[model samples]
Target: MPPKAKSKKKGGNVKSSTVMDGLSTEDMSKDQLEEHIIHLREELDREQEEKSYFQLERDKIQAFWEISKRNLDKTKAELRNRSRERDEAEERHRVEIEVFWTVTGIHATLNFNEIPSTGTGPMAPQHDGTATKWYCG
Candidate 1:
C-alpha cells in the first residue's frame, strides 16, 4: 500500500484546516441537513415571538385611537344639538316679548281717558303637568 496522505495547512491554524478537509458537502446525509433546517426554523419562531409582543401593543394603541376619534365625533354632535335647541328657545322668547308689547300698546291706545293699571290674568289650571301660575293685579 502507498504511504498515507499528508494534510496541508492553508491558514494559520492547522487543526481548523484539518477539520475542514475532513468534511465535504456530499458527505453529510439528508437527515443531517434536515436537522439543520429544523434548528433554523426554531430560531425564526423565537424571533417572531419577540416581535409579537410589540405588535400587540401597537394594536392596542390603534384601538385606543379609534375610540378617541369616536368620542370626539360624539361630542361634536352633542354640541351641535345643544346649539340648535338654544337658538330655537331664543326665537320663542323673542316672539312672546313682541306679543306682550303689542297688546300693552293696543290697551293704552284704546283707553286714553282712563288711568292705566296692571290687569289680572286668567287663572291657570293647577296640575303637575301645567306649571303656570295666575297673575293678580
Candidate 2:
C-alpha cells in the first residue's frame, strides 16, 4: 500500500487542501480564493437583479392581461344588452303594426249611416206627415 500525501493549510482556519468539484483549493493562493469569492458574489448579485426585473415585467403583463379581459367582458355585456333592446323594440313595432291593421280591417267591415239629420231633431215629422216619437220601456 502507498502512503497518501498530507494536505497543507496556509493560514487561519481555511484548509488549502479542500476539494470542490474536481478542483483542489491547495493550488489556489489566498488572494486568488478571495478574488474568486468576490467574483462569484458579483455574479450572484447580477443574476438576482435580473430575476427581480423579470418578475416585475411578468407582474405588469399579468395586470395588463387582467384589465384587457375585464374590458372585453364589459364590451360583450354591452353588446348583448344592445342586442336585447333592439329585439324588444322590433317586437313592439311589429305588434303595433298588427294592431293597427286589425283595427282598420274592423272599421272597413262596419256600416255607417250617410244621410244628414233634419233640423227638427228626433221629434221631427216623417215624410208620411206623422210626428216621429220614441218610447224607452
Name the top TM-score candidate.
2
Off by over 4 Å in 1: 1-46, 106-137
Query: How many residue-pair clashes does candidate 2 contain?
Result: 0
Residues 1-137, model 1: lDDT tens digits: 99999988676763311112355435556776576668769999999998998899999999999999999999999999999999898778667656886887633123222333344433222223323232211
Candidate 2: clashing pairs of residues: none
Worst 10 residues of 2 by lDDT: 128-137
| Model 2, TM vs. native | 0.59
Q: lDDT for model 2, please.
A: 0.68
**lDDT per residue (tens digit) for residues 1-137 in model 2:** 89998988667695446554556667777887787789879999999999999999999999999999999999999999999999898778667756976887643222223433364633233333232332111
Best by lDDT: 2
